[model samples]
Target chain A: MRNSKMASHLSHFTHKTSFFTSNPRRPSPPCMSVVLSTAPTQSYWASIDAQIDAYLNKSIPIRSPESVFEPMHHLTFAAPRTTAASLCVAACEPAIHLMHAAAYTHEHLPLTDRPRPRPGIQHKYNPNIELLTGDGIIPFGLELLARSLDPARSNPDKILRVIVEITRATGSQGMVDGQYQELGLDQLGSEYDVIEYVCKKKEGELHACGAACGAILGGGAEEEIESLRRFGLYAGMVQGIQGKNKAGFMEEKIEKFKELALKELESLQGKKTELISSLVEPSLAAVQIS
Target chain B: MRNSKMASHLSHFTHKTSFFTSNPRRPSPPCMSVVLSTAPTQSYWASIDAQIDAYLNKSIPIRSPESVFEPMHHLTFAAPRTTAASLCVAACEPAIHLMHAAAYTHEHLPLTDRPRPRPGIQHKYNPNIELLTGDGIIPFGLELLARSLDPARSNPDKILRVIVEITRATGSQGMVDGQYQELGLDQLGSEYDVIEYVCKKKEGELHACGAACGAILGGGAEEEIESLRRFGLYAGMVQGIQGKNKAGFMEEKIEKFKELALKELESLQGKKTELISSLVEPSLAAVQIS
Candidate 1:
């Protein structure tokens, strides 16, 4: 049933870059289709989700310690698909999503005396299990990336670079620092500079890391990697800023960031540029529609 | 003043393996001395602690978002020295301690409703900051290890292998799983089998990872790595079981584990073998003295 659904999507994108087409190591199913720039966002997401599901199933075998693995599996599957995952090459999509899920798990941890009801996975498990599961997901993500290293096809240096990129983006100076700052936001007051700094570190850095890793893994040159890293950073800033405010200043800031994100792709020529642009366009559309 | 203290300790161990001597890449202090097997544990710990303090000071710079980095630094420096840190090669010792500090932070997180006062760094920070600090520390540990990787001196594959070893030992099926099982221990009832399983996964696996990583980084052969891994496992099991109970059965179990741990080292010969045995002897002595 899943294969037939994937087949249907494949048939629609014969001229475009499909996940299976991007990764030649995996045998493409008999009825494979390519993805085009014109493909609906839902269909693109469907392809990514199917691949993520397949990857998770193969990589994380459900075994003993059902208590831990089960929740981790649920959170990974349930995590909302984001531009960060979509911006990656197919090989890195699952690992990117694993990171997203791990961060999401910690972000929603019940640190307060009266915990708010978190959407999706948190409702299913108690707080303690959730905390431990978040801890497990991160190492699991690193292991996935490490396991994916192929010296025959990829450079070990690049893999190490990707690991460093991801770790730095998520480490003390990045996402966690952002979260820590957010906790003190009430005391610091919500000045625009403070908000931007926190958003850039928390949301923008992870997105930047994702794009950078994808570029490194896909064998892009240094300039292309930097461009995509900036693109991800600008696009992520737009995403981070969207719900934080509804004022004119925030709107103008979003438009500027969106333009910057697209400008980063202007120098590059390929199907990937269009695919990457599509990731940002939806957020802009969401803003305009709202 | 610190240098004088280090000099005094260096004078006591002129013939044994010292941390600085193990890694020729690092320049030794002017009055450096080699460590011998007879060097007191306190002197070893002081040397290790001094190195840890220096490493943390160098690696984690105090910068913006002092709220996060400060607590992370505090937790890392304040964490008790363990045999795992001693078992590593000098170059990898700081990274090993970072992993320990990261795990220790999470292990002592205020998960229960009635929070107990934790011994060290926890006393300084609120629960929220402590939680975020733990989140930050893990990625910092990974970054530290990745940054330590130099293709000139270390094989990227070996470094990747060590990363996998540490992540697996600390991931869902390892330390986190053990913590989750401990949470459910009330429901499951603590049979010896259950306790052993938890201890092996939680404590033993981490020690095994430390020994295996040290061996890999130190260029040990496969047989030697396996032997050290088993040695760490048995030794860690004794450490885990030591405080759980004082019953005769528990003592018998500790003795058996200690013997097995010593037996694993019998095939190996060198200063390292003596160094490795010293890691376990202190625990045994504590048990006997009590």
Candidate 2:
């Protein structure tokens, strides 16, 4: 009975055209346009958002055990946009978004037995369900990317490379490692280097992964992929630093990273980077607002 | 300091030759000889174990953030053998083992804040670390498989198919779904059909995935892969049922699955069946021992 009800809700959620499709009950687009006034950039971002939503709707098949799928759909679709998914180019957005949603789910898991008072999906569901839902989501994301591989239409090797990139970014050496280090932050102390390293691994690498995947999927040159990867790394660092420290305290460090991010974009001279360039500033504003 | 210690331990663990290489400190091989007494079969199983061990040692590179890697290595290499990994034919063992290890880690997680007293990796680590470790392990497994895709040596298309197979088997409709449904077992009741569906989804699909991957890696024909897949599904269902019910209560059902498992292998009459066919009986003995 419960399964059937959840399945119906899941169908409805997946059928919704886009998260930003003027649903009065839903909150307006959260973080885009905070610093930019360009209409073209806004439309580009909206297009990417719609692409992600459409891909998710088609890919996440409604099946048995709605208990797990329901939470995965809810957590993924209902969450506000992170810089992670928006940074991607081409069809990589949905795959990257799924990966981000998985990471977000695990990152927010309660360290203790007591459930943390958090908003969004975790707040509504029990921790066990959330944990399993996360376990399920990662593979679903990988499946989406794997399914996109076509010998005639796209470079299978590039898709393989993207898989390796995404996995490495999220694996032990990347995001998970950063999260582990955070558990012992007290013992490690508050050195800038330590914080930076952790922040890069936890947050920067994922953003870096998204940007690199975007370039890879977009058929960018090797140099372009590497440049965008660095751009994402620095941009993610700004977000990470802001997240760790108060807005004013890390302004100098944040500015340094923001400049570094723009510097990396210099190599992609002819490419349209207004949307990408706009990704870094919003982090600062978002941190300030919170 | 703690990170350094863990890194040292991780190095020692990864450098070990083989899990079954007669470590006096370790228990002898547990269930390999339970039913089959053939010396050749024992040697075949040993070789597969060594291959998996070699793959792990070579592929799992030692890097920074030892906290997460340490637990991942520990959980993966130190766990007792499951029928899942042993059933694979060729180089897919390591990849499948990693996936199985990830599933095993999630399966044993304590639902409440209070830790469950279990053996192996979880017994040593806190639930939070264990949870994060599981999250890291899945991608590591996928990385191993993706890293194996050398277009010069193997079929990239087949590798992609295997990736889809694995992700699908372990995704929401597979093992995680089984776990989720088990959480509501009271409402689900003890109907044979319900139990069979859950068991097949949880255990059977993974086993099916392993067998199919092995066949795919070996460049077996499509029909051969499908046949081996069915064989694995039936064998895994026997194990699943035995796991849920007492030894005596499900013997009849277990026998039915055992026969079904053997029947699926009928199409591959020319192929060697000794090692594959031997996988089914041990589950019965294993369940009885517990």
Model 1 chain B weakest lDDT span, ten residues long: B28-37
Q: Write the per-residue lDDT of candidate 1 for residues B18-59, one digit (tens) a residue.
A: 323456554332111222335455565566567556656767
Every candidate's chain B TM-score: 0.78, 0.76
Clash count, candidate 1: 5
Give DockQ per model, in order: 0.47, 0.42
* Fnat of all models, as shown: 0.68, 0.62
What lDDT tens digits, residue by residue, belong to model 2 across residues B147-256?
A: 66433344566767788888888888788887777666325656666677788887788888887776675556788779888988998888888887554677898899
What would the TM-scores of all predictions be? 0.82, 0.80
**What is the fnat score of candidate 1?**
0.68
Error of 1 at A97 (Å): 1.9
lDDT per residue (tens digit) for residues A1-290 in model 1: 13233333333333344322456554332211222334455565567567657767756666666777788887777667666665664445566677777777777766543355555634566667777888888877877666555333445667677788888888777888777777663345657766777778877887888777767765667887898899899878888887576435687778888899899988665524554565667643222100
TM-score of chain A of each: 0.78, 0.76
Q: For candidate 2, lDDT tens digit of each residue in A196-226? A: 8788986799889988886676556788779
